[model samples]
Target: MSFGALSDIRIVDLTQMLAGPYGTMMLADHGAEVIKVESPTGDMTRPNGPWHTDDAQKTHGGYFQSVNRNKKSIVLDLKSTDGRDALLALVRDADAITENFRVGVMEKLGLSYETLRQVNPKLVYGTLRGFGDPRTGHSPYAEWPAFDVVAQAMGGIMGITGPGPEHPTKVGPGIGDIVPGMMLAFGVLAAIHHARRTGTGQFVDVSMLDAVLAVCERAVYQHDITGTVPAPLGNGHPFMCPFGQFPAKDGHVTIAAPHQSFFERLCDLIDVPALKDDKRFASPELRGRNREVLEELLAAATSCFTKAELMQRLGGQIPFGPVMQMDEIAEDPHFAARDMIVPVEQPGSARATRIAGVPVKLSETPGGIHSRGPYLGEHTKEILRRAGFTDSHIDRLQAALPA
Candidate 1:
């Protein structure tokens, strides 16, 4: 059953793909009734899959299922008049609506924020874009289409990521899109609260480029204060010594003991107590200045032990953790205890598969993944009935769906 802080809130989600859908997913996870309005052909990610070996139908893929759990789906071809009317009807009572279409797409479809606000003045309209909507601020790149890579490149993340400035690298995950989606979720909730208080709502806009830049906040201040541009330092920090990944015999482990007490303790645990008193590594500043020498020494010491051995010796003594891969993470008991790894039924297959679980824990009204994402148009009839559409009207809406 849907039960959480937002159980009474309903969102008409016109978003698709990663960024927009992820934001709505956060709300839906917290017990918001998110009605995902899709085209008749369904979301583009519906076909994106490394399908389960036992599932034959493949109605929805892992990408779609990951961010779309606990939501209802209804097909609506916004290009058609009937479909537009149906969406309008749904928005009339919705607490909020979200979209990630490029600028002018909604305006062309006659469902722009301006138009929707007239239908429901208090409706919270949240949008995620590559740049930003012109209604808020005009970006020269507003018309330009963008995905994860573009945002990462243009938004300063790629500039300060990877090994060095000459070899900038895209982050492994799609933080370009994902971070903006998270920001959009926060913006939506903030706007919803404002609407409830003042009986008015304003357009909420999150630019992918802006969001990625926000993630690289430290770089901005560093450049401004030091008058020097920041570049990637491989896995090490610019100011901290012995704070990055160090090689173990079998794998790697990250160690952070920049403070004197911790550093002394770490040296003693690693059987290098004399190194802590060495003139070159006596202070944090000295250690940072002589990082290369200290790193070499620490690596030589740590390389004598395997990751498991290092963990056994220093796991809780200092800020230390093994650089674990997915296989290790999957088997880690901490994930099981915290419910960070969850298993859900693989539709059309008897066996269950795992997905990442909710990280935001609410002690009173907890949110959870109780079900998988819906099939295309899985709740079309039920949703339309709740929206006050007659059966005949629902049929007409269905007829208007894209072939």
Candidate 2:
């Protein structure tokens, strides 16, 4: 049964891998009927593994399961005329479709946006690419294939991230893909809304490089306004003092006391109340100017206490928190209270495996994870039947799929 906000919305997902699957996952979690149309071999990530020891049937690994959850899968060989017809049948009733293929892949398959729109004029076609589709705007690097690292570097995040200017580091998570995926989801919803109002749908294009650059907004304005290229400042902020990670007795803790009142309170809690009045740190501008000296002093004081001890001392008084790892986060009461970690019964595993919970909370109609990721072509017959295909037609379609 469908649950969550988008229960009436249907999506034909012709996307695979991290970026596209992630965007559709968000929609599926919110009760969209997401029909994942895959080829005969299935998504490439099905083979990527961090398999559970107890799960012998390794149909999909963690990477695939994590993003493809709460969706149905069907195998379709778009190269075949019958397969293309089947997809078009599904599209006729679908509100939107998403893909992440290269510039010419969809056109080669005879399933371009112009082609799909003919089947359903109200179809919102969303695409995520390294440079973006030509329908939105052409880029010089449109043909260049890119992954997370390439987007991170070319988008300017890597230029101003990491320990120093000499050593640019990629962000730990795949924000390059994930962010663009999120934007695609938002765009799809917006286009769908417009379609409902005016009975016209449009193409939604999101470039991975553009998404990353949008996220690195600070660097853009800083360079344009001040004529200075931004560089990595380690864990510290360019304008704020005492706003980065500091060493504790056991580990690191983050402290952000940039405001005057908060800074004074932080000084008092750390037993260095005199620092609030010091000429080098009396004002926010002065503290930023002499950040190195102030950080050294604060580090000396903070290093004497453990992370837990520091948390206890300044938990609510100032904006402070200990740097948490996965293990710690799993056991934390805050995560439990917020439902940030959810356990679902994995298909092959004897015990339930944990994945992150949905972050969006709606008071009236909340979203959730109702099911685990589907096995390859798990709902093919069911989906085909629902799309008005006869048993004989489904058999023909299945037979035509690549072996």
Candidate 3:
């Protein structure tokens, strides 16, 4: 298996849903052998839809396939003694294990970090929770069940993410889960690095609320430094004028002419050369203070050109972008040139399904989408055999697991 950078590592993934699975996939993308351990019932997303098939009758749908690529699946009924023993055996040689179960679920199952450490002292235990694992500290909401919306609301990202203060909105994607997942991947790598060096491993956790807050830190710092509770200012930035979306003849465009030189150049391109030196908008601070007036002036000029026309005039001279929908992005030459999208062989679909490709390019040892997510318990017997269980033992285990 020529997995990329983490090919030497093995991850026992007990995670379900978006957060934990997303993090495990990051490792899998870089060549780690990720064994996704599911309950007899399997990951909840296996039945989720938006299927790519014409009939939309696929066993697994887009949601599961999107984040779960490059991994294998195995089923273990952890309620049974045989299952627990099997996992302990697998853990004894594994590099890491990750889960998104609530505060005390693992402890109740007797598979807590303390117990797993006894099996594999170098096992890095990573978790994502709405609050956090109790091992770190008991959040008052430790036992409270949460999802992406809860984290976004509590974490301050939603507080400043909408058209205005009265209209705060959740972000378009599940950033609460996704960002924490990304951080957990980094945390696992760090823990594994230290464990390999010192022959010890530790529990690593990320609170979804904490991760969202960290990513939306500008709001926090703004509140602390200036006592100005940051609120959404439509599509523009707080510190820079002429740095947001503006309407064009056909669609929208964005310009980031924050610098004095860039502002002068933008003015020349727009045929409003006098505004570049006007006292009311000559400097960034002045422009910011009078952004309302400047935007009205800029919007009037920009509304004359189509998006493509603006791109032609201002694309290279200053920071500029066309507001691209997915259909446009699918045909964009830049994305194709960079390989930002690729195809994976999905089972139910007649042909391969396209998913976003790896953006973190490493020229010499680049990571990639290696394979599609496995079928439910697709490698159960194979994995048990690898764990030193004989065919007879595997037969017993499979019988105990749900078919």
Candidate 4:
């Protein structure tokens, strides 16, 4: 069997919920050895929805299973001296350790990077916090907890999402968790590369607020250039003409008519030659000034055709796509050809369910889903044995219910 690009790396994942675990899962998918240290009570997401087909075994929640494949799990209570010692043993030789604990939790356990450095100087310590590392301010709520929606609201995503002047909407999906996870994973890989080259490791920190702000990069710049805050435009582009969702006979399709040439192509393709010469629709600036008129005219033309017919007629002529639902995506032929959805078998009799495959495609050392994530502490004995503990010692350690 061939290992993937990150085959030599090992990651000690001490994250729950979404952000930190998502980062480690990214590494695991690329062939890193990720050992998820769960508390005696498993990850909170283990109880989240779309549970396995079996009514009895709620252990394998689809939410938990989705981002956590290609990793092992080991139950440990870090507050216990013995458990911390075991973690130290693992960290002494591991490449990286990732956590999303609120600030000070690791120090409370005496396992912060400063302490861990004494055990392994080459350890790449990565952390994700809601605000930031406690260095900036002793915020009154410094140690307060946070989740995805809170991050989005605090970080400015909610301010720019909705349609009307009074309403603001948070984006769909937990981008608060996902963006930080992607950034942290990139940080980890960069640190690993540096460690491999210079024989050193450094701290990598990401804030949920900071990550969300990064995703709102354009909005910040717009706010800076103009004294006015940008309002939500819904399915419309703020600066580009004919660049938004248009109604179809059955549904809606997005048209990114950003350039003048493309805009001309769109008008021509829709058989609206008179629009090309109309005073209000002649230029992008003019079109923006009379958006309602243009939209009504375009909607009339588009509403006459089905999405399939429109796509067949103007597929390559314009930047166009249907606003697909999740069910629609599952049946898309292009998605199938790309192998975006892959099937994996589980313990249930319902056969196997489909999950997303790896996105980063390499020519030689490509990544893949090697195996499903382990049951809680499924590799406890195996890990202890590899850590040089004897069989009896392993048994004793496992039997001890650490704090």
Model 4 lDDT tens row, 180-287: 998899999999899889888888888888889898888999999987787778878667778888888889998887667888888888878778878887788988
Our tally of clashes for model 3 stands at: 1
Please give the CA lDDT of all the candidate structures. Answer: 0.92, 0.92, 0.90, 0.83
RMSD of each: 0.9, 0.8, 1.2, 1.8
What does the lDDT read for residue 345 in candidate 4? 55
Q: Residue-wise lDDT of candidate 3 within 1-403, one digit each (tens)?
A: 6858889999999998998898888889888999999998899999887777463458667789888999999999887899999999889889999999988898899999999998999999999999998778888999998899999999998888888879889998999889999999999999999999999999999999889999988888889999988987888889999899899999999999988999999999988898987899978999999999999999999999998899989999999999998999999999999888888887867777788887778777788998988889998888888999999998888887766
RMSD of 1: 0.9
In candidate 2 the C-alpha lDDT for residue 97 amounts to 95
Q: Which stretches of candidate 3 lie over 4 Å from their true place?
A: 55-57
Please give the TM-score that candidate 3 achieves against the real structure: 0.98
Q: For each of the candidates, give the backbone clash count.
A: 0, 0, 1, 0
Model 1 worst lDDT window (10 residues): 344-353
Per-model TM against the reference? 0.98, 0.99, 0.98, 0.95
Off by more than 4 A, model 4 = 135-141
lDDT of 1: 0.92
The digit string of per-residue lDDT tens for model 1 on 1-403 reads 7688889899999998999999998998899999999998899999888788888988867898899998999999899888899899999999999999989999999999999999999999999999999888999999999999999999999988888779999999899989999999999999999999999988999999999999999999999999999998888889999899999999999999999999999999999899978999999999999998999999999999999999999999999999999999999999989999888777877767688899999999998888889989999999999889999988877876668
State the local distance difference test value for candidate 2: 0.92
In the predicted model 2, the residue pairs found to clash are none
